[model samples]
Target: MGSRLNPYLSFRGEARQAMEFYREVFGGTLTISTFGDFGNPDPALADQVMHSQLETARGFTLMGSDTPPGMDLVVGNNITVSLSGDDADDLRGWWDRLSESGVVSVPLEKQMWGDEFGQCVDRFGIGWLVNISQPQS
Candidate 1:
């Protein structure tokens, strides 16, 4: 497999719910593994998600996992997953789904740059940016 960059979110304790929610929004195959599966000696975190991945039908990838026992999960101001493409239908569909149960920071619409853009923090508190490029004149 070629090298590719994708967002990996860290959740305090809801990694499974959050990843599952993204799967529903984007329609993807979600795979989650728990710390216990990896032989985590700490029983407290045994059921926590060690890694989770959602690969969407539209060629989108989202990866996440619960914060380990020692990591400090500081919400906000650390990461934002961005989706950008020229497909208006697909991008708009994603925007609608993502914002349905979440708060929209910016409504999706045509922007000064001539593209349809929006930003929102999903129900799971993950920030997202969608930019749909306009067709050439």
Candidate 2:
């Protein structure tokens, strides 16, 4: 029950699709709650995801929710979720999954920074930055 910080994405009405796609890519236990599952207060959004959490064995937690009826979804370039570590194999695997069906702004390759770095915008328009640091000599 410790405090945790994770990215919370906001989608207009594609939260379920995006989250499910993430579950497939990250290999995690995904739990999603819908507005109807709550109390049937909003019939229109009853089927839409009220909240979703993906906790992967890789120790990554991604949470997201659909924007309520009145809320505006302004997915700007203000934020980009970043993944960085020394696990080349694992990180590259994630890069392959994330970069799939999306736009790769920077190809994942050995960067001048001495790491495998790249950036991509997922099909849901979520920006991601992955960096696999090389072992120090």
TM-score for candidate 1, residues paired by index: 0.91
Error of 2 at 108 (Å): 0.6
Instruction: For residues 65-102, write the lDDT of model 2, one tens digit per residue.
Output: 99987887888798899999998888899899999999
- Considering every candidate listed, which one attains the maximal TM-score? 2
Give one digit per residue, the lDDT tens place, for model 1 in 1-137. 99998899999899999998888778989999999999988999999999999997767888999998678888986787888999888889989988888899899999999999999988889888999999889
lDDT of each: 0.89, 0.92
In the predicted model 2, the residue pairs found to clash are none
lDDT agreement of model 1 with the native = 0.89
For residue 127, model 2's alpha carbon misses the true position, in angstroms, by 0.2
